[model samples]
Each structure stands twice: as C-alpha cells, then as structure tokens.
Target: MGRRGDYKHFLPLQTRWADNDIYGHVNNVAYYGYFDTVVNEFLISQQVLDIHNGPVIGLVVETGCKYFAPLEFPQKLEGALRVAHIGNSSVRYELAIFKAGDDAPAAEGHFIHVYVDRDARKPVPLPQQFRKVLETILV
Candidate 1:
C-alpha cells in the first residue's frame, strides 16, 4: 500500500457486472477506467474541463498499476485521486482504489497527462486556472 496521505480526494465508484472477467474478478483494465472517470469527473465538476470547446486538453502519456488485492463486480469502490507531480505541460495523477470503507487500497496506480491545444493537439503549458484546480487535490 502507498502512503495514506498520497491522495486528496475520493470518489465513489459502483462496479458493474461487465467490469469483471470470466474469472469473476474485475479485469485489470477496468481499474484504469475508474481512474480516468474519477479524474475527469472531478475536473468537470470543478468547471476546469470543457470537453466541448476547451482550449486545453489532457492527453494520457503514461500509465501503470499494481494490484494488492482482488475486487469483484457489485462491490462499491472508493477511488482516491491526487496530483503526484506537475510539470511544464504535464501532470502525474496517482490513484488508489479501495473497497468502500477500507483504509488500505486494493490497488494503486498512476497516469500522466500532458495538456495540449485542442485544435493542433500540440503540447501546451498548463493553464493557470487548471493548475489552481489541480493544486487543490495535490497531496
């Protein structure tokens, strides 16, 4: 497990039946989906991300995961999100998936997103407002 204070925000996630594979556990790929969903929803809720005409967009550049326990469908999850690092045009997001109410995480991972221009899709500096929003979630 990672440091208990690594994350600053928590989002509840309800696992769906399709999230589990034939072996009856959540597929590994589904964890990444949870990560993305939590982060994006946070941004949207904060009005930092405007998918329709946002000048700046985040593009995933890297991702990784490590499972410490198994998670099955119908289980409720609490995904914790935090900013691990912030660079010129990129941010690394650390995620921890916990079965609801569990102090220790079932899995932990991180993914990097490089902000870019929506039209040209070229790397751009992190906008001031976006940075501020992210700062609130930084551990």
Candidate 2:
C-alpha cells in the first residue's frame, strides 16, 4: 500500500540471522522491532529523547502492521517513517519496510506513542524537543 518515496525519513537496518523463522523469512514480530529501533535511534540522534533521563518518555499504546512480502535474512531492511498525526501528548508514526532493491514497501505499519511523565506515568504535553524532531517528518 506504500511506495518508496512516501516516507521522508529512512533508516537502513541489518537483519539478524535470528530474525528469520523456520520458513526462512523474517518473522512478523521483527518488523515491529525495526520500527521502534528506527524511531528511537532518530530521536536519540537528534537529542530529542533520552531513554534514561528524560522527563517525558513515549509509551507505545497502539500498533498495527501489514505484510506485503516476506523478507529473508541477509537482506537489508530500510525503515521509512513519517508523522501521520501529532497531538498534545501523542504522536502517530507511520512506517514502511522496504527490502533492499525493492521499489515499494514489503511491509507497512504504524504505532502511536503517548508521551508521559516518567515518574507519574501520566500523559504530558509533547516536549519541545520532541515536537521539533517530529516536525521534520510530519506530513
């Protein structure tokens, strides 16, 4: 359902041998991990999220995925991301997985992360840094 250029940000990820299932394809669950890794890597690299010390942390409250093709190990997976929606306390990240040399996404998904207080566990306004980074991908 998505094309290669649909997303603004891209992260190339190496598929581990352990990621493949008996059928020799990357398991369904691995796709979600790739999504989370790419998003967090971007946040950390941008100095927007500090997993250990930030006052606000994102909690994954919702997730969904669709597979269009099977990905085998040894193939590089490119995770593509864009902001579909952003609210005061939550942001919806749309993502797609493109296998190396593939013209379109082999898998597509999204997850909503609610920014909450690390101590109180209550939703909080999006941190200024968070908004700034997210805006780069917001469509």
Candidate 3:
C-alpha cells in the first residue's frame, strides 16, 4: 500500500462513466491507464519527453498493480508518482491512485521503463536532462 506522503508528484484524475464496468467500479485495466498518465504527465510537464520526435523513448518492460479498494465514477481522484529506482538505462516508477483527500491509496503499482533509441529500438543511457528530472522524485 502507498500513502499520500510517499509520492512527490500528484495529478488530479477525472473518473469517467465509461471507465466503470458491469461491476459498477472502475475496471482493473483502467488503473493501468492512470499509472501511465501520471508518469507521462510528469515527463511532459518537465519537457523531458518528445513523444513523436525525440531520438530516445522509454519502453515499458515490466509492470504490476495491487488493488486495496474499489473506485467508482463520480468520485474525485488523484494519481501520485515517485521514482523507486534509476539505472543507467531503466527507471522504476511507482504509482498510486487515491480518492481525493484520502491518506491511503485505493490502488498502487510500479512499472519499469527502459530507455531506448527510438530508431534502433536498442537500449540507451538515459539523457542527462531526463535523468535529472527523474531524480527529483526518487525515493
């Protein structure tokens, strides 16, 4: 489980009606989308990632999540992000989804992204600027 204090960056998430399944809760796959959003949002805001034109990009090689509570539409939500590890060519990003104002996360997860050359699709050392931005939230 993750607590509010554990993350250094946060983004307000809007729950959509379509996100709910027949179970009346946000579907399991939707949580992964939230996780991706937070990480990319951080990178974009920092001007560290160029989705279409950059020479380098990150490829997700590993990911997992644990659900602690149900999340339904029509509720305020937030996504929290932190860097758990930084290797020469990979970074482990830990993320959590919380009901707004809640102390504990409704769900938590992590994904490892290996930086790679976009053209060759080969692993590459992280750019100094990108690594510096990641270090800001390292824990």
Candidate 4:
C-alpha cells in the first residue's frame, strides 16, 4: 500500500532477456511469474510447502495486477510480499515489484491461493506451519 519497505519479505530477481517483450519492457504476464517465484520461495524456505510431496498445495483462484511503470531487460528487481487476508482455506498475497535501488514499486498486485489436497484437489485448511509463517507477514 505504501512502498517496498512496507512488505515483510523481499526476493531479488534477475531479469532475463526473454522477460522483455517486443515493446522493450517486461511483459505483464512475466510479472505474475515474479510474484509466484517470491511466494513459493518463501514457503519453501520456511519448510511449510513442499511442491512435490506435500499433501497440501495451493491453487490460485484469483489474481490481479496494476502497472505503474515499465521494466526492461538487465534490470535488477525485487519482489516484495505480504499476506493480505487468510481464510480457512485460502490466503490472499499482496506483492510489489520494485526496481532495485528504488523504494517505489514498479507494479503491485494480489493473488489468492486456496490450499487444497494434492490428490483430491479439494480445499483444505492451511497447515499450522503455513498459517504461522503467513501471520508473520500478514498485512
């Protein structure tokens, strides 16, 4: 809601050549990838999420992005993250893409991840460990 500093965690990202589109700026779709990368990385680092073997997995049900500026190749960027909301089986993550060395965000967005059983794909309450980590960064 304010600046990059407002988020609880940050993950630096290296812009790949392919991230830029013909317009010479990072494509909108690529921004989502950046968002997912940071969220997943944090979960993995905390050992709350296991993509390959965990019984619970998150399924994104909603996502939206707002562009404030263009990002080009070779730019160093950071993905800032915080939890905006947490339901019984879903959590809303707020994210901002900030150009390295800048406090302002180049883009802002939110995505909702509904935790579900990996096998049945039915919504399930978030694990205690998952909820605990999310609480630390809840906005």
Writing each residue's lDDT as its tens digit, candidate 2 over 35-89 gives 9998898889889899999899999999999999989889988998999999999
Error of 3 at 11 (Å): 0.3
In candidate 1, residue 69 scores what lDDT?
Answer: 94
TM-score of each: 0.96, 0.97, 0.98, 0.98
Which ranges in model 1 have alpha carbons more than 4 Å from their true place? none
Q: Residue 49 in candidate 2 has what lDDT?
A: 92
- Per-residue alpha-carbon lDDT of model 1 for 1-139, expressed as tens digits? 7744667988999999999999999999999999999889899999989989899999999999999999998999999999978899999999999999888899999999999999999999988888999999886
**Top lDDT hit:** 3
RMSD of 2: 0.9
Model 1: lDDT of residue 26? 97
Cα-based RMSD of candidate 3: 0.6
- Residue 6, model 1: Cα distance from true site in angstroms: 3.0
Q: Highest TM-score among the candidates is held by which one?
A: 3
- Alpha-carbon local distance difference test for all models: 0.91, 0.91, 0.96, 0.93
User: Candidate 1 at 74: error in angstroms?
Assistant: 1.0
Q: For residues 54-139, what per-residue lDDT tens digits would candidate 4 score against the true structure?
A: 99999999999999989999999999999999899999999999999788899999999999999999999988888999999998
The list of candidate 3 runs beyond 4 A from truth reads none
- Model 3 Cα shift for residue 68 (angstroms): 0.4
TM-score attained by model 1: 0.96
Give residue 112's lDDT in candidate 3 (0 to 100).
Answer: 99
